[model samples]
Target: MTENDKPAEAHEQDGTQLARENWERYQYCVSRGHRDYTRLASRLEGFYLGGGEQWSREDLEILHEQGRPAYEFNEVMPAINAAVGYQIHNRMDIAFRPRGGDATKELAEVRTKVAKQIADNCRLHWKETEVFGDGMIQQRGFFDVRMGYDDAVLGELSISVLDPLDVMPDPDAKSYDPKDWADVTVSKWLTLDEIEGQYGKDARLRAEGARALGDEDFGEGDDDGTSRNKFGWQDTGRYDAEYAGGGPRRLRVIDRQKRVLSQMQVAIFPGGDVRQLAGDEKPEVLEQLRANGAFITRRMMKRVRWIVSTCDALLHDTWSPYDRFTVVPFFPYFRRGKTRGMVDNAVGPQEALNKAVSQYVHIINTTANSGWAVEQDSLTNMTTEQLEEFGASTGLVVEYATGKRPPQKIQPNQVPAGVDRIIDRAAGTLKEVTVPDAMRGTQGPETSGIAIQSKQFAAQQGLAVPLDNLARTRAMVADWIDYAITKYYDSERVFRITKTDPLSGKEVEEELTINQWVPESGGYLNDMTSGEYDVVVTEQPMQVTFENGQFQQAMEMRGAGVRVPDSVVIRHSNLTDKHEIIQQMEAASATPPDPLAEAEAVLAQARARLAEAQAERARAEAVNKSIEGMFSSAQTATLVAQNPAIATAADGMWKSAGGIDKDAAPAIPSIDAPAVAPPEQNTNPLTPANPSVGMNAGIEGGQP
Candidate 1:
């Protein structure tokens, strides 16, 4: 057949089969591959090198064209062959590509070319080999070199070729062959499913073995002499042979004792019995064992023995084990009953003696003859015989009784016999009595001892004089003092009456009364003249004048004659005249002419005029000053003749009708004006009239 029409031959013996198998395997690999290539590349140097590097689009396209075909042929095809086996190869002739069929041959030729081109152009390569060892054999396919860029190598592409029968397992029994195959290939030598089954079987076997060996080593009995085993005692042969029937039996006494010892060993040294001592006196036991060359001391045993001995000694008092024992008395000193004499004899006797002495001293000091008693009211009112009897009764022991006599009695409505004589005598002895004028004028006699006693009694009862009455009395006295001073100052006998000014028609009648000048009047009178005068005029006299549209005034003394100008009348006339003048000026200037715009225009014009005037005046002044200060008379004369005003009025009138009138022009100006001339024709100052001219002639000709 022609090359284009020929059916493509498979590169390997089962290319279609291999393609299908490897395709399935590659799909599984890509699905199952961990996205940890970068990490794996970093750890494993040869497996994958360039990490974190992206494949360019062009590179990816190239790889697609070259690497994809090789992958399909070498890797995917082999995996599919291993998975689907002869089925893919057999079906390929009719299903995908049939020999001598138009469609099948065309596809086959295209695929064949693609595979050949990939194998020729790509950097990757592949190899296949059969591995046979230990009870199994299988075909393995691997890539020679992985597709890569620069120094980076992608993962090795590979697939396994298994026997056709090996791929499918029976549904009834467990799949052991696949499990075994998995055991050979994976890193751990076990698939997840196999590991799970083995783990379950191991657990079941462990349970069974544990049941068979139940409690045999512990032997049932505990350290407290109780059975350790849960299964009770029973005949073994007569019981049914059930799985539950077999169990640990109860332990014996000897075994329990051994268990107790083992427990003690564990408690003492958890590491082991050989590492510890068994005794209460651990240090001493250790020292003894060391001295005796023992590897370890029995500290627990020593402790048990010591406890037993101590208990035995406590039970049986032998050899006086302790030197002395403390004895706490049942009753302490404070709790004991006191002796009878402590309360009744010693303390009671002393207290009684103190009380009796105190009473005796009190009685003796209170007796009448103790000198503390004086002649009180009782003795004073008593008769001489009665006082003597009282002194004897009171045991006063006195030689004689000097008693006070009673006061003489006063009869009602009858003065005493000496009272009249005393009054007459007092009248004649007034010189000796020396009564004060205030006391003599009093209507009642001066209060004696009775009045003073009555007053003192009233005061003790919190009695007080009336405050309002006392205040009124004080006010009356103050008013009297004020009246006396006022009358003294107003007394005409002491002061002469004089009028400050007489009225025009009447004589000065009873001079101005000084009595009118009271503090309420806010003034004092002149003492010598007895005339009323103002002490202060707080209201100052002010005179105001209105003149020339203003008002003013002046103040003068009340008595001093002051003539004030008639400012009100003068100011009225002046204001009238000012108003008239203002009205006239307003009438004259009050024409509204687009006022704001006119003002602006006027202001602008004024500004322009001011600027021009300033410039011209400044220039004229400068010329005048310059010429005046110069050293030439000609300049001065010229400057004088250049005065515009002088020129205008040369003949007493400005004669400038239009241009340069002869009379209006200056005769001798400070700076001369150039002579005026008519314009010349055909002047070309900007061009050279001849080409041969030098620069100097050109410049001179260029000047206008």
Candidate 2:
């Protein structure tokens, strides 16, 4: 046969064989991975619901299990919840370590912008991963990352998380990063409408699907869990024909060529064909699809999809230009333990503690709430119904009976005293193992705030395990995202993100375009021209240290009576709008104090009073002088009246007074003065006898 013809024949054979083998592998993986896991699922479900799965008929069959309330006294939920108790979610920071050396100023800016874009994407997808991580802790052993195009984003690139339960791996894989793998598939339940919305009416396989679907020729799917396991993921759907009708989801199998995912194919369950069909295609086109990952459906079987078009070429499978798939599993030791037949390998002592607490809680509650049967004297109680009614009612009522003896009451046996201690210890241990006490805000109000903060810091340090794992997982996804951005973002595009302003150290919006990062700017592409670069991953910067440390410093400064800038204090606080706050503080400080006019007014009042007092004394002295003059004038007038010359003499005296004549003293009755005793010899410094040589000499002689 001709070379082209030989490939066509080989293609048909590959299609049939691949379908059978894949269906078998799917069944095997279910048996090994997810089927036996119903028990684990039950435990995880109970942990969240606060008790084991509701008591079933199977549970009721055993006399010991009846009347148990699934009262889920939960300690597991708290531990799992606290494990990721971060005030901030996006704690990761990315820096590109260029091979040659440091980058230029412009190049550094570009790299920083690039890091922020990736970080923004991580932040967008991170919350979901945390949720999945909780599940991974509870039941699912691990979670995964899927990087793809997001139309909602400006850059069109985004990241996503995958539940571990949604994925099925090759049954015989030895390691996480195996040298080779046959295949891995991810499945999800979707409604008919969603399928129609995504794949559309055009997705109908045409006449070929009608001819091939449920055809006896292709062979049946492996329905058994042993020979060929077919348990596909957590079904999530009620399999109801009505609401939430997305049952039996089409699983997407990522088939590999050598090591990388070269194509994508859909799986078909063992059921009648419900797929719409299209017009026939040439045998040559059909043959070409068989060689690739394409398949036709059969009842309880797998299928290779082919397109019927004018051009003799395969479609869809090759549309994904990303030669490598973006899905990467985060199971740290998935490959290692699975080989050793360890299911739920990630379950540690913490899980055991969690289960023990759950069991003990059930026992205690059941003992008190349900197991305890009330009893009374059969004659006094009379009817069983009446006794039940009395037991159920919360209100207390009593009926006095004179004839019969008072009814006797009997209570059920009490649980051991040690049960409370055991329960308390288990809860404490769970907190210790998964989440620390400090992280949960369980530290009492009486605890010192600083001491509590220290405990929190220590607890954060202890959480290094999961945090580190998170960093590592996110870093891997980031590497792929970086690669995708480099390859797919050929055209210049702007990605706007909120970034921390370098100088201000505050968040501000920024935009980075493709040209800003690639060859145009001296960034990854520019650096690559010189030498390759490495992706260095770091957990999101711990602002706790910056925040709490600054806060403590501020508080101490306040205690020390130091003048701390209001803006500086606010920076360490929970307040927002630092720039606005700083501006307000600056304005307040810039404003001058109100002038001290009141003090000036008081001083002015005292000066005015002194001036008024001086004026009053002057007026009184003038009045006294007037009175003296008037008295002298009256005496002169009386004498002048007796002698005609008196009036003339007064005028003369006024004239003489200017010339040297003085007015005679107006006399009153004079009394004889007692002679002063001779002054005793005095030692007054001012009146020293020998003035020149004594203490008062300097005053008299200037210097003796």
Q: How well does candidate 1 match the true structure in TM-score terms?
A: 0.10
> Candidate 1: misplaced stretches above 4 Å?
1-96, 99-104, 115-127, 131-704
Q: Please report the candidate that would top TM-score against the real structure.
A: 2
TM-score for all predictions?
0.10, 0.58
Writing each residue's lDDT as its tens digit, candidate 2 over 349-411 gives 334444455565666655442421323432342454565445435563444345644443445
Candidate of highest lDDT? 2
Lowest-sum lDDT 10-residue window in model 2: 306-315
**What are the per-residue Cα lDDT tens digits for candidate 1 across 96-213?**
1222212234333333232223223332111111111100111111111112223323211112222211111112222221111111111011222333343345323322322222
